[model samples]
Target: MSKATSPVRFKAKLLRPAKPANAAWTFLLVPKAASAKLPSRGQVGVEGTLEGASFSAVLEPDGQGSHWLKVDNKLREAAAVDAGDTVALEVTPSGTMPEPTVPAELRKALAAAPEANAVWADITPAARHDWIAWITSAKREDTRTRRIANACDMLATGKRRVCCFDRSGMYGKGLSAPEAM
Candidate 1:
């Protein structure tokens, strides 16, 4: 991993969701202009300081064309800020895929199913990222296991991306999103 250093800097105002929405995100939405300056238009590993507290995250798309960096509760408290605050961001690439942590269950399933494993390997890195994101995003273990099973099935059937999932991966496949509505 490359050392964290000065990165493309920007100022953006944090905003609350208009209503109850997908639990998948709660991220800091990086502006389009800032996003355009980054190396990858797809999911990227990034680290920066928000409100003086440093953070690490993946810049993902919101199914729309724009990108966002997820800010979990721990970061929010550490930063001493909340929605409606303007934040300073210094984003640098980590020189690795941001969301590549695959679950053990999914790995076993993939190993057992050659066709699915072949399809998994055949898909683009971006697609694999989406699948992993969906499987990991589930709040419950059962939900995650179901997602893993579903992913294997879909891959075996020659499907590339998950339904309702996109570049940002804020919402898992088959889950309704307020962002989309």
Candidate 2:
């Protein structure tokens, strides 16, 4: 097996739900261990098993010296955990894996739009991942360019992936949007 896929093991406690909205589920987390070597934000291919069910999560650093393991909601439901369940976390370090390189033309276009870059940088890695995935998956260049332009416009205006346009056709700012585009 490739070293890139090797898993690291750690013990974690399921944190108690901070609010009632999250009370239905629990989180098994690595919560900033001073001695633990955790992955940084945007690291991919992280895997773990919670309650005997294996799952994958993306590691995102909170910038306060801690990282979050973003597991899918379906997996969370399957685990039947509540806030504060002690569990184990296993993850593979993000290796020298190649990511889809942005086309030169697209890079130039993005570079020309400073506001877009600023907004894009401010977004979460997961959101950026979605945009990259969409653009790279397009079978045609025209579609990709159009989507890129739209994405740039959305970023410049600080609108997220889904909430760029509201029901009234007006854009709202400050945390109502997904910021994942």
Candidate 3:
């Protein structure tokens, strides 16, 4: 359900990653009470503005059980937001995450591995997104191919996700697809 900005809005200083373990620079303050009225962090489908820049994002739970939004580099640039700046944030439940696109190779691999395909169908959209992100994050053609192959192997054997994917976006210390060199 869509919501007006007023009720869901808050002003908080952007914060840096708190420690070595928290590597993502993100918004420091979230209206925790208001967020409870929205979807859970796991299903953070929300459309809102950061300092007036419009974006779609997910709010996920942190170790302390509070919701946090990761403002990626692109969003920070577009909004001119930086760590330590106080900015207005408006978040409303956008529902579920947009489905991640499966690479053609991953699709082909899944087709050849019926077991993986079956498991794929049973997973939540978020779980599927994890696999897709891991596969698509690969910058090199060969790397992407390997991730796809690995995805099939894991899924075929009933693995819900690639082991150690930093799905939390925390320190990003997981099985992330290699970025372009």
Please report the candidate that would top TM-score against the real structure. Answer: 1
Q: Lowest summed-lDDT stretch of 10 residues in model 2?
A: 172-181
lDDT of 2 at 12: 66
Off by over 4 Å in 1: 1-6, 18-25, 98-128, 133-150, 153-181
Where does the lowest 10-residue lDDT sum fall in candidate 3? 172-181
Residue 18 of candidate 3: its Cα lDDT? 49
lDDT of 2 by residue, 1-181 (tens): 1233466666666554454454444444345551145434323436567666677555543334445554445766677664455656666664433233466765777799999888776776556655665454455889878878877887788865534322111122211111111
Tens digits of per-residue lDDT for model 3, 1-181: 4433343777777777644454555555466566556644333567888888998875654433345667777888889978878888877666567665677888789999999999998888788877876676565889888888888888989999777765544454332211211
Better of 1 and 3 by TM-score: 1
Candidate 3 regions with alpha-carbon error over 4 angstroms? 1-7, 18-25, 100-114, 121-124, 129-154, 157-181
User: What is the TM-score (0 to 1) of candidate 2?
Assistant: 0.44
**How big is the positional error of residue 38 in model 1, measured in Å on the Cα after superposition?**
1.1
Clashes of 1: 1
lDDT of 1 at 180: 22
lDDT of each: 0.70, 0.53, 0.68
Between prediction 1 and prediction 2, the one with superior TM-score is 1
TM-score for each of the candidates: 0.59, 0.44, 0.56
